[model samples]
Target: MGKSHVLVIPFPAQGHVIPMMELSQRLIEQGVKVTFVNTEVIHNKIVTSNWINKDGVDDDLRHMVSIPDGLDPCEDRNDIVKLAKSISQNMPGKFEELIESVDKEDDTKITCIIADFNMAWAIRVAKKKGIKPAAFWSASVITLASVLSVEKLIDDGIINEKGMVLKDEMIRLSDSMLPMKPTNMFWVCFEDPALSEVAFQIVLAAKQASELTEWVLCNSTTELEAATFSMYPQLSPIGPLLASNRLADQTGHFWKEDTTCLAWLDQQPACSVIYIAFGSFTLFNQNQFEELAFGLELSNKPFLWVVRPGMTKETATIFPDGYMERIGSRGKIVSWAPQQKVLAHPSVACFVSHCGWNSTLEGVTNGLPFLCWPYFSDQFQDETYICDIWKTGLGLNKDERGIITREEIKSKIEVLFNNGMFRANALDIKEKVASSIAKGGCSHSNFNKFFEWIHEKDS
Candidate 1:
């Protein structure tokens, strides 16, 4: 007779938090009492960013809570290995305590726990508390399949127990997925051996935790990866979880977005502006930054680029000499952007992106072609999906020096523009994604089933 209560937790990264927050909003709309949890540092950023507007008196069923990530305020939260280790060690006990406190303060009891697959320890804690557990994979289903295939990789001797690649070869998990080099495995992609080992252990833990989950939800669609979904029937495709789908402003940004960019986009000619943005955590050396700048200049096309703080290794992002004067009015650069709106704008042409899953989905849903410049980890795999599988994008080739030259950037932009097929493919994928979330579509059916399951009295 009481409203079902759910506790939602996401890995404390921008990409992970946004999708999980969107899912929480969906649950709220369904009349569920939801508690959304974030790390203390991330929560502070969200609050200061003013996206949530907690002061507005509206939804009493929804709440946002934060727990310490076990790091001091001055610590570098950007270091993935350190942050991962700290959360694994410190957050579990803190999360359990939060649950106990919430029960004492609220009338509804938490009936289920939905956690990011990366933070599978929450699933363990949920089980220990006799709460139903579900795992949400924010990235592509192919990536999830890869993470769950750690044991098979070890059995095949492709990787060692510590997640080191023993053999340098291309392998495919199934005929449905793309062939990838052994070295590119998510855990093995780290440059540091110690970091790779820790990442591997985390992956192993997630896979083990998955076995205990009652439901496995993925922010993907069978339309995009039908073959992979067929291979792993457990993954339910309920995503492209964007706020735009529900006609709401996106939340969970670590940086405040610049709305002026939207006005600048409106002034540009239709399909004339190049939109470039790398997701949070991408860093560039001074050389690459300069080259990217000159490349955008050489393209001679109107462009909007997001140069987030700390994007470059140098203390400050330095443009080429007289760069601002030379490209006056032709270029617009902002520290952070309203990406979903930018992608949806008619003036935007194509995306020059780092190929993070969130950016990939945004571009795909908006029917924009891509010029892929993947940096590391799962991004490389995402590029393969964009360029090879979907044929909606082209990859930028780095020179022998491992820097993408200005000429290469200019050339790829020209190629992407000249080719109509890429846009056609992009539009085609966009239509499929639209249909998937529409009534009677696969994602719609899956979401309805999930909703029913969550409301089940026995669950």
Candidate 2:
């Protein structure tokens, strides 16, 4: 057999790329030759972003190849709806051509494709090119069960073809899984036409993956989602594909990490810090930003916050007068922090997060209790799992203004630390997460099985 060469593609978002990137590095560690592919814009951002640390990986391994996303240079790829549309409409042909060129030039021919589920068209394209295709569902498997059930949902009149929930209710994906708010079906669950288009696109992609693929690679563990895994036997859970477990801290981030946070964390007493980060894409309005700042101040807790560029909506100012000075050395804020380092820090006790799956798993991986403030898409679902089913997190409720107030934030912190109940729960879940990734653990065994599938005889 020729070398096991795989073409890896992600959906071009920080969240999507990081897990796929982790998977790529893991494959490389297992002696698979990998061609890592990303959209041209995302690749440039990773190269230019201040948060990346590139010295750790080999130059050959670090080499990234890009394909056009079919958007004008001036287009804002940050706009999720337009970006999703562009990727769906554009990347398949470009990727197909890249594969052909690679097959001719490289000694090892392309044997398979491991693509992010959002880019389902790549699987269809792989079929045409006669390459094996596997889809990576980047979010929780419970979320996948919800997405893969789209057709059943439509048949039951629960959701429309456009991905809209026809009735306002909770959606129970499986008997053992936590039920979800119908409105939080996904990012596309919104009634807005633009968001609806993206939702439908996701549904279509899910359909393609369920119908066309033989094995679905998920970034979750069977222990974490046992019921979901049992419900869909085709999904092989090989994750919490955390950088820590894989021995790679270079999971792709679009911003430079502030190493200073580590030094800052080292000074604080054990479990005394509250680390706050609202992932890459969540933007805040001026009022909401000020409210959060005041909320953090009111809590009077030692905190490390990531306030990225363009995070606030044309607010002209993100913090109120004297806020930073009031907190003084008690709080640390940067555009980005090496998250895994901070989460793993002994001083970091509670997490104020956007409930993105990566952040959720990071919290789980590090055993940090959560204060869930979800931002968009499937975040609500992950939060539900954390706070509702898993009981490792506390969801912060928005006020009458439909905002998370300073008082609300302050109160939640006090409540979370009250007798340290949530921390105890988090530690229990942490044991499961650790065991899932340890040698001969569930994820380790599942990953070995996945590699076997990759090396299986097609005939």
Candidate 3:
């Protein structure tokens, strides 16, 4: 019997990479060999960080490999979309070559690929050979359904020459319980002829995604999105992948993780602190930043905020004068903190979030309630599920220009904190999330099924 090997690739970003890493870890635990591919630039960053925290990842069972992303490393993150567009034309041959090199010395066949939804090129590569490829959507199932529905939207002319342009009025989708104007699927959903050309290139990539032997795999659990799962049985829901009580994946980041915040949380009362983060990529303008700062202060609640360096162009000027001092004793701020640890802390009561899926799962698993502020992509959909279907979170309604004010922030926080009803509901859902990931649970069973499929047929 030869070794069972799988290649795992994620869309090049922080939130996307983390879940793929978790899934890869699980595959390794089940006795499969794994190769995780990141761009050279991202790979270098991980390597430097590896020296700082040797315990973060198992260097033996899993290996990190790199390929040229076909983009200049000098470009900033905001320009990543344009850079990614360029890669579609260039990376296929490079990736095929890399696969050849891996196959040369080993008896293991490149049996299957589990790639991010954005990495649709892998489907073509897998099909060109005899291997299998499956797209993994590390988000709520509603989001995957929404992205798939974009083709339906295009056929309906809901999108204009601008590619799903929104008028000042909110446009509602039939799948959505609430009204939300359709916008960019971050950049791939645009309709501008030039951008649509890029978008069409992506659709060219996405449409081929279903050609894989296995179908889409989402990180959400079935109980959370029963309607979505019922509609697309092929889109398997195997997630909320946390240990009991959100206690797992404490391996920390590629970099040395600081635990000062955990010590700080110990002194706070149980479920009394509001934890605020905007996932990895969402950014705020100065006005919105000050508004959030003032709103948190005005809410008169103890709060912990993760304000990353890339969060704003004018981050230094965004905070109000004496703002840190005004909330001095009650506030804790860090450029970055061990997020999973902070979310699981006893004092972390509520979350003010950008509604990214990873954070959504973490919050639900921990039983913390939410104040949802969605930015882009499927975040709005995640927000809808949190506030509407899940009954665990509240959404922020922005104006025509998408600006949310301090008063709105303060009012929502007050409503969330004072409403014993909301907290109870959030906690109730939390228990369900925990149960689904437990032994003999739905997600657990689904994972085992996936493992067996890979081993018996593909591997």
The CA lDDT of each predicted structure is 0.90, 0.82, 0.74
lDDT of 2 at 50: 34
Model 2, residue 27: C-alpha shift (Å): 0.7
Which candidate would rank higher by lDDT, 1 or 2? 1
Residues 1-459 of candidate 2 have per-residue lDDT tens digits of: 545788999988889999888888888787777888888888777767632344322444433678999899999876768877787778878898899998898887888898888888888888888889888889988878877788788898888877766888776777777787877877455647687777677767766765787878889987677888988888888889888744448578887778898898889999889899999888899989988888888887898999988898884645898787899999999988889988998999999999999999999888888999988778998888888777887998887889988889899898887757788888888898788878899788888877777767532
Badly placed stretches (over 4 Å) of model 2 are 50-63, 245-248, 457-459
Over 4 Å off, model 1 = 54-58
Alpha-carbon RMSD of each model: 1.4, 2.3, 3.2
TM-score of each model, in listed order = 0.98, 0.95, 0.89
TM-score (C-alpha, index-matched) for candidate 3: 0.89
lDDT of 1 by residue, 1-459 (tens): 669899999999898999998888888888988999999898888888886666522368778888999999999987888999999999999999999998998889999899999999999999999999999999888788888888898899998888888989989999767788877777888878888888888899999999998789999899888878998998899988988855445678989899899999989999999999998878999999999999999999999999999999999989999999999999999999989999999999999999999999999999999999887788888899999989999998888999999999999999999999999999999999999999999998998899888899745
Residues forming the 10-long window of minimal summed lDDT in candidate 1: 50-59
Judging by TM-score against the true structure, name the best candidate: 1
Better of 2 and 3 by lDDT: 2
Residue 264, candidate 3: alpha-carbon lDDT: 86
Order by TM-score, highest first: 1, 2, 3
